[model samples]
Target: MNAFKPYPLRDDFTLKNRLVMAPMTTYSSQDDFHVSEEELHYYKLRSKTMGMVIIAATSINDQAQAFDKQITLKSDDYIPSMARLAKAIKEEGAKAIVQLHHGGRMNNPTLYENKEDIVSASAVPAPREGMVTPRALTEEEIHQTIEDFAQATRRSIEAGYDGVELHGANTYLLQQFFSPHSNRRTDAFGGSLTKRMHFIDMLIDRVNEVIKHDATEPFILGYRFSPEEIEDPGITLNDTLALVDMLKDKPLDYLHISLGKYDQSSMRDQTDQEPIAQKIQTVLKRKIPFIGVGKIETRESIDHALSLGYDLVASGMPILVDPNWGETIQLNQPIKTVMPDTLPKPLYDRLAKYRERFQQSGYEFPVEND
Candidate 1:
């Protein structure tokens, strides 16, 4: 039970195990931005066997939606559905965490009906296809976005979730603000590295303020971040190190690193050959727990990630392939690595349609009987 050991995240909360179900967008929510019955079933299937289940990146506002079926926390009207979704995970003895997100410039133009509605720290366009050039957010709008996150936190607390993870990774709004390639403003929210971090600092403060004022129980607050960016003058490893130093003293429960490989080396311009997570750990110095997520699938992979000094390991694709991953491990059963055709019809059809997209992200979603 090396990987199955209980982890104390805080004095008030402890996880049953160290294996977390990484949050992955299902694109299965209802049309009106509520959690659908299919999505609830999807979570229930995966929730029981993990220490914690992080729900997909959910929209904090209607205009911030990136996916067609993404769940929303923009208004209190959606709390009942959110509460049900949280209960589905918690009923299985897993802590439920919802990733708070805003698409920023990555938002679909048709959803807003005007490109100007899509705002970011600067007017830079995302490097991805179909992304539109965004209007730069005014200083007032930036403060408003921080309040939006605070309000979302309050709603999550009311919905009975154990924690909330800020989606500061994968080139979303938070990352956009920190990346020099995307955030070109000369205001306090951009320009220098310290300036870029202003948005995140303010966001964390506001969210913590809400948790302090409204939360009845201790609610975990986690931040997920990518360590490096590829563009010139973008987020380098040094920049990330500085960011980690700043965040280490914050009241965060954990820092989750968003990567494609657990043992991946520097993606920045640094000449050092150390693994990225190791570098981040050196900066953190155990001040906060580190949750490492990448292509962690097998028992050996989890052990290897832990060996690299990760406090917890998270899996995404493997759990999608086998919902009872931890249970199978405990029973000495072989865990499924490849997708199976015998999946519930609805889920199987949805995955089959998005098979190519998954592959593009370096995941091999092969059918078992193929």
Candidate 2:
């Protein structure tokens, strides 16, 4: 036999084929964010051959329950279903991570049952249409938010999840506080990068307090943050580095850097997309993993990124267009990507099937709020 060659993607914590399945919103959960078998099928199919499977952004706290069919790690009732999904994927020998999330000013305004007004870093109503005006969270409530994340992190461990990812990208609750356009407060939580990042800082501190004992087992504490916002200047890549430096003490397992505003103009208003991930990787000199994503498709591009020193690459459109995307790319097959929103037939069919099967059972529409 030839000299043994180490598996290219096999690391101490994960034995993936070099892809971390980017979390896509399937909206396939039933009432209370319970993962339907349909949802499990979508994820399990990814597990068949992928390196790592990160569940889509599952809302972790009650106030963050901004979408329907989005899975939850907060509810005890949801624990068994989530645990089963986790087990199903892990039994296939793939590492499983859950993306935990929240929405601040951006809570979908159409959820019929939610009466409490959306809360945020400030009390301003979202400039975008449909979002309700939000009230600023009190200091006590701020502390509660930290505890909520800790509780969710604890739940992720209890549910047998290999890791938990904080969803801090794309102008969500955390992003909103970090966005100048969304947050206009003079308080300590605003005005400066260090102050602006207080929420996430607090969240990590609380999470550490609870999970400090299990520090050895890839207890991933990764955060996805944006380097640029649509028209906002509150948080830029420069400000981001300062905050990242502040967060170094948390000793995060990964620092996922991504860009693109939350609004429609975000991707379009760009001058030149500087392949942002590489630039960020240079700034982040630590040895912790660095993950980058946004419009990833082909293997060569991903390989190029890996060669350029990105710790991991995340795929979005390619996977959405083809569930077996990674395996197909590895096998050297040509793939024709389709725009799910533009096309008439397949996209409509998938969306209808997804909604009908999910909403009829009481899953909320992600774009609509309570």
Candidate 3:
């Protein structure tokens, strides 16, 4: 399949091409959890090349925030803020997708002024050192959380977005509710694998209801997920395969697998060498579009991903480093490895602190030596 060709979705929504901008958190929102002018500029700068741009994870509520400076869609009041972001991307001729998120156990209490206790499916702390054990939500709160997601979807529609991607990957609230390591509840929401998926299943149902009622256009809905977790007894390949089975026929436009490399193999079982994306695709069987992302930098890498049979490809860091990534690739221009001085300070500092990550990926991050 040609990478530059338009890909059509249900209800007449067609992507300009098979390339998408992966959702990446910038830590650049305003104090009130609204999109800052800097972030709008950032999106506007990066939106020109892709068929769709999935904005960084935005909190669904105040409590859902995982870090300081996260964008929120917690209430109707933030609609205009999001509308501006949607307009920024859409005006560039790319579809804008908001990633609706809740931090759950990953919520850092210090980010909250009062330091509220974080909630999860159970009272399990993340396996990382110094992590606090979270409070399990009462059954009532679980239902309320579902409603929160639905309301956020409604806001995204009103804000003029082309779609919303449920932020289920990256060990966030949705993944926490599904992971055996995080969700230990004995109720209908946890226990067996089937039970652990209850929260996600219900959440999807609610979000769909909102789309059916609120969306004036052919809105896109997608789900993103990690194929496995490194923690002991955490999500495994088999577990994710089962998840793909459940999500394949759901009211979704695509399934995006989060990974360090698009063709990465199983982490838990090193002996299983099959790339996890290919495994999930075997189960998906073309039921829904599959977006493959991870270190997809150059035109060659994008072509390689397409050779692997992905329906669409997502570009992450390359777009951040170079706003004109697509244009450069189309013109056979060299991609930049150095971090530009023009980025938002927080995002720049964060990337600078972790410059070694870029080096490890064979991408340079040469900063100006002032």
Candidate 4:
């Protein structure tokens, strides 16, 4: 199938074309996970033509939190507000999917404070310097975390969202479990590939349970995973593929691939690599949808990715710069090229402040930067 000629992500779900708005963290949602007018306008402008809109990473809870303004699905109180946001997106006719995550080893003062007890597959310190060593998650905390993701997914549906994307990439909690550099556990949750995959299995199962109970359409349960970590050198494409094999039989709907652990980019030239998400589509031989992420800004690159077997194409910096990129591309209009330095200019500045806040208070920012 020609990916460029309007592809469907699943039998019951499809995009107008293949363009997907990459899920980005814009803390437009301050104290409440509710979408603000500015964020609403931002997404509405992009939804004019984008095939699908995956809302930015919303923390499941404070522990899973990434920043102060980061949108999340944590409470029943958050539901009505998010429902409004979801309804707005659906009104645009673009499917709404929210990325749910837990910040594990990567430090985010809002989610986890000086409480060094960072849970991972094991108690391994991140390869980066200056951060306190993470405390391993007790077995019970492990179970609770899985439950948190499930509950969060359920809440997302209640909020009128059509689907949920697992924030399994970017060196977050799930990604940490997949990394040998981070997951040093000896239990069933650790050790070999199968063990490492256990966490993914549980999360997927809970998400599927929610889907079945609600009897919704083939709502997306996309997996965003990195192929390897730049700092800790233990993983390879084969390792990631092994887990992919396990997921194939399960009900995973999509795999949004990107490389390099999140924190590694802070220390090395990790961002210098081409968006590895497209390579993920090439390396995996499967019918499930695949997407590429990075500095995808032009239609030609997107079409090239479609030619390369990417069922869905995602643009990050382009969306950050012009949430109306899809509409502009539809009109064949040239946009200001987003260079590496200015790609995620908005998100870039926020993370800088987030790090500063984390260092200062080891707690969450109380306002909505979203």
User: How do all models score by TM-score?
Assistant: 0.93, 0.82, 0.96, 0.83
User: How well is each residue in 1-370 modelled by candidate 1, as lDDT tens digits?
Assistant: 2889888988889999998999888777787989988788888988888999999999987567887678989999999999999999999999999999999998877788777889888888988788889999899888888898989999999999998999999889999999999999998898799999999999998899898899898799999999898978678888999999999988899999999988999876457778888888898998998999887766777788988889998987667877887776556565544455324344566677778756665556776543
Candidate 3 stretches with Cα past 4 Å from truth are: 113-116, 339-342
lDDT of 4 by residue, 236-297 (tens): 65677687777666777888866322112222334555434434444567667777665555
> Candidate 2, residues 1-370: lDDT per residue as tens digits?
1001112332446545557777766666865578777667666766765666778788877788667567887767778888899998888766788888887778886763554657888877766778788878877887887778878887888788887788888678888877776777777677766677778887877786766754446566778877665464556656666766666557477777663311111242366455555555566665567766655556666666665556666766556556676777777675553323332232335564555443443333243211
Q: Is candidate 1 or candidate 3 better by lDDT?
A: 3
What is the clash tally of candidate 3? 0
lDDT of 3 by residue, 1-370 (tens): 7777788956488988888889989898988878999899888988888889999998997679897788999999999999999999999999999999999888876775554458888998887665677889999999999999999999999999999999999999999989999999999999999999999999988999999999989898999999899998799899999999999978999888899899789989899898887788789998999999998877888888877768899888778777877777767677757556546677877788888887776767877732
Q: Give the higher-lDDT candidate: 1 or 2.
A: 1
| lDDT (C-alpha, whole model) for all candidates | 0.86, 0.67, 0.87, 0.70
Checking candidate 1 for backbone clashes, the offending pairs are: none
lDDT of 3 at 125: 88
- Which candidate number maximizes TM-score? 3
Sorted by lDDT, highest first, which candidate order results? 3, 1, 4, 2
What candidate 2 gets wrong by more than 4 Å, as runs, is: 1-12, 112-115, 214-217, 259-274, 337-370
When superposed on Cα atoms, how far off is each prediction in RMSD? 2.7, 7.0, 1.5, 6.9
> Once superposed on the true structure, which residue ranges of model 4 sit more than 4 Å away at CA?
1-5, 110-117, 259-283, 337-370
Looking at model 3, residue 248 earns an lDDT score of 92
Q: Give the C-alpha miss distance for residue 285 in model 4, angstroms.
A: 2.3
For every model shown, the clashing-pair count is 0, 5, 0, 7
Once all C-alphas are superposed, what RMSD does model 4 give against the true structure? 6.9
